[model samples]
Target: MTKSQIGLRERKKAATREALSWAALRLAVERGLENVRVEDIAAAAGVSPRTYNNYFSSKAEAIVSRHCDRIRLVGEALRERPPAEPLWEALTRATLAPFDGAAEQPDPRWTAAVRLLLREPALQAELARAGADAEAGLAAAVAARTGADPGGLHPRLVAAGVLAALRAASDVWLRADPPVPLQPLLAEALRQLAAGLPEPSSS
Candidate 1:
């Protein structure tokens, strides 16, 4: 196949995946995650149930994939950062870049879906699976920058640490009573990670 044909195929797949994710999240929000069926999501996305199954294993996976997709973008952003930039700085910027302008104008429906996911055990499990996939991609990106083997411990550890920090920061942000901005929480999390996670002294 031609390069253009490959590109078109990739774009079509991305569109289909995105449609499924949006439909899943919207339906989950409207009818609760437990009540949203795979067939329902496929119908909402204008795809057959088999097509939906090709993209996701379950309704929870489809809904959680929206956030997982952004995590993958973070890996891409890290790869695109200037090579001369410090790894931590590049990571910090890349990690938070996707969330820029989103905190200020939060989408109510998205927020609702997130809250639902946080509360649902099945969705959390799907999110964990998604995170593992994101971590592997991020490890490859980090390896590319550091000239380490993608499967080596150094790249994998760094990727895992960065993702863990982001997860912790997200939990804190989500639990905040007034709903703190995610970017700052994420930035601080990365900063602390970069700073060697110094222990705080008792006052």
Candidate 2:
């Protein structure tokens, strides 16, 4: 096949994967994560169980798999930031782009589904694994931005710090009664990170 044809084929495959994942997440949110099976997700996506397994090993994976794409978007955004921009500013802006764009927002039911994942010990582990993958992607991006070795501790540490702040911000927003804007919470998180979290006074 020609290169353009190959690109189109890959795009189609990606679209399928996204469809399956979105369906899985939606179902999990509507019901409960544990209550939703792989077969259920496959049916929801109009695919067979074999196809679902080809894309994801388990239901938990299918639910949170799109996190890698989010990381890549943030990484690309950071890469495109002006050279004079501060690291925190670039990182925060990059992190916020995906949430602000034309992409479909998660249903309100999905928000509750995420809370269920957080509460479920097994699903929580899967979520953590997905998070680790995102962090690795972010680390590579940070290494490229600062010219650090990809495997170096600095890149990993910086990536962890940034993601931790992002997670904390999300948690705070999620727990709020009316749900506050994520950007301001994220900004404060970055600010706290940049300022090195306040230290207790010495005795």
Candidate 3:
């Protein structure tokens, strides 16, 4: 196949994947996760059930795939940071940059849907699968930046810790009563992580 053809094919696949994920999230949020099925999501996305199955194992996986995509984008951003930048500085900037994009503006409905997904056991399992993949990608990026072996302990530990901080921030943001902006919360989380989680002392 020609280069243009390959590019077109990849773009088409990405569009399909995005459509399926959006449909899954909307349906699951509108009708409850237990009420959503593969066929329903495929129909909503204008794809067949077989095509949906090709992209995701279940409706829960489809719904959570969007978060997984964000995680992948963070890893890519981290990889592109200046090589001479301090590890934590690069990580903080890279991790929050994606959320800062104009296309990533806050959506209360989407945030609520994510909160609902977090409360679902089946969806949480799918999220764990996605998290594992993100962690592996992050470890590689850490290794590239710090010259540590990707398979060794240092890179893996740093990647895991950074992800944990981000996760904690996300949970706090989602649960906030008045709805806090995610980017600033995530920034503070990374900052605290970089600062070694120091305690406040009376001065």
Candidate 4:
């Protein structure tokens, strides 16, 4: 196949994967995870059950993949950033790129739905498993940008640090007594990380 054909094929596959992931999350939210089957998710995505099987082994995996898709997109975004941009700046933009046009404040109903879905034990397990893969994807992107070895410590640390900020930001967002905009929290988290996480002076 020509290079353009190959690119088109990959884009189609990505769209399908995203469709399945989003469908799984929506169904799991609308109906509890236990009530939603693989067939249901596939149907929601307009794909066959067998096609869903090609992308995800379980409903939990399909749901978790929605987040993974964002992480993977961040990697792609980083690659496209201008070479002169500082690493942390590029990373911040890359991370937030997937969220552009997102409401500064997240909708409470959507947050509630996500919280309910995340409480599932099976989904928790899937998140734990997926975290490593997410980190590796980011690490590879960092390596590619800096010409570091893909397996080296620097890229690995940078990836781990970014993920840590994301998780911290997420936890704070979810647990905030008075709801706050996630974008600011996310930006702050990355800024702190890039600044070496300085100690706060006591009042």
Candidate 5:
């Protein structure tokens, strides 16, 4: 009933959500998506199947929730960047923060699993919805920092474009024949956007 109690309750809910999501992703990676079920995920997370259903409708949603949480956190990070920092610079740093330490090339098995997950229709839908939510959150942060209207074209367009660049960069990284450090690829993606996406010259 008190403020501290309310905060603690919300924190507990968030922790439970994260645990279920983490379990789903781990199961998918270890046993493949088709082999995993909501029951399996709930057991892994030490929650009942009914509790899992309260948080996520399907296995795909549970798996994608972890990535979406990171996306949502990027918006929070952007809001905390120095107010005087250039918009693109702050945006780039916030976006890359979640992925910075994961610079090592991915294992081929993980890449294969990710590729499979990306191709799933349920996950694709979840990802699309997550992108929209992330764009809205980032646009609000941009509006606050730059004194622009969150619903206006400038904030909306910038947020949408930034997320698009993120998706493109992720796609490129997944398809890289010899896997490369994702942070550099993601940085290059944002850098290209900050530069107005200049065309490359032929060698």
Candidate 6:
């Protein structure tokens, strides 16, 4: 195929995927997340059920598709940071980097969809799975940058902690009434992560 043909094909595929994702999220918000069926979502996207399956294995997966790119984006951002930067600093920047280009004005509808994902049991599980993958990717990148073993304990532990901070901050942000900007929330999470989750309690 010609270069233009390839570009067109790629763009078409991306558009189709976005359509499916938007359709699924819309249905999930309109109805309950559990109430939406793959067929119904596909119909909403003007695609066949088979096509929906081709893009995503389950309804929860479809609903959270937009966030998947954010995971990889975080990983890539961390990888590109200056070598002298500490892990927490790099993680803070990487984690919130995706929202830099997003509209400063909060999209109420989109926030509602995020709230739905956080509350829905199945979608929460899917989100956790995505989070786990992101943690692993970040760990691998960190290990490579530091010349440490990717599969070793330190990287794994740090990755888990960082991912946990991210999850906790996101949960808080999702429910924030009048919703604060995500960047500050994420930075606070990193600060908490840096201070350590463990502390000496007043006896």
Top lDDT model: 5
lDDT of 5: 0.88
Candidate 1 C-alpha error for residue 17, in Å: 1.2
- For model 5, where is the 10-residue window of minimal lDDT? 100-109
For candidate 1, the TM-score is 0.81
lDDT values for all models: 0.86, 0.77, 0.85, 0.87, 0.88, 0.79
Model 6, residue pairs in steric clash: none
TM-score: model 6 vs. ground truth: 0.79
Model 1 lDDT per residue over 72-126, tens place: 7888999999999999999998999877755753555566557766688988887
Cα TM-score per model: 0.81, 0.81, 0.88, 0.84, 0.88, 0.79
In candidate 3, which residue pairs get closer than 3 Å at backbone N, Cα or C atoms, i.e. clash?
A: none
Deviation in Å, model 2, residue 145 alpha carbon: 1.8
Q: Write the per-residue lDDT of candidate 3 for residues 34-148, one digit (tens) a residue.
A: 8888889999999999999899877778887877788777789999998888989999988887677423344667667768767999888987888888899999999988888
Candidate 6, poorest ten consecutive residues by summed lDDT: 99-108
Candidate 1: stretches off by over 4 Å = 1-5, 101-113, 149-152, 199-203
- lDDT-based ranking, best first? 5, 4, 1, 3, 6, 2
Model 1: clashing residue pairs? none
Error of 2 at 25 (Å): 1.5
Candidate 4, 1-203: lDDT as tens digits:
99999999999999999899989888888888999998898899999999999989888889988776676677788889999999999999999777665456666787788887899999999887778887888899999999999999999999999888888888787766567877788899999999999987698
Clashing pairs in 4: none
Global fold similarity of model 3 (TM-score): 0.88
Q: After superposition, how far is residue 103 of candidate 4 from its true place, in Å?
A: 4.1
Determine which window of 10 residues in candidate 2 has minimal summed lDDT. Answer: 101-110
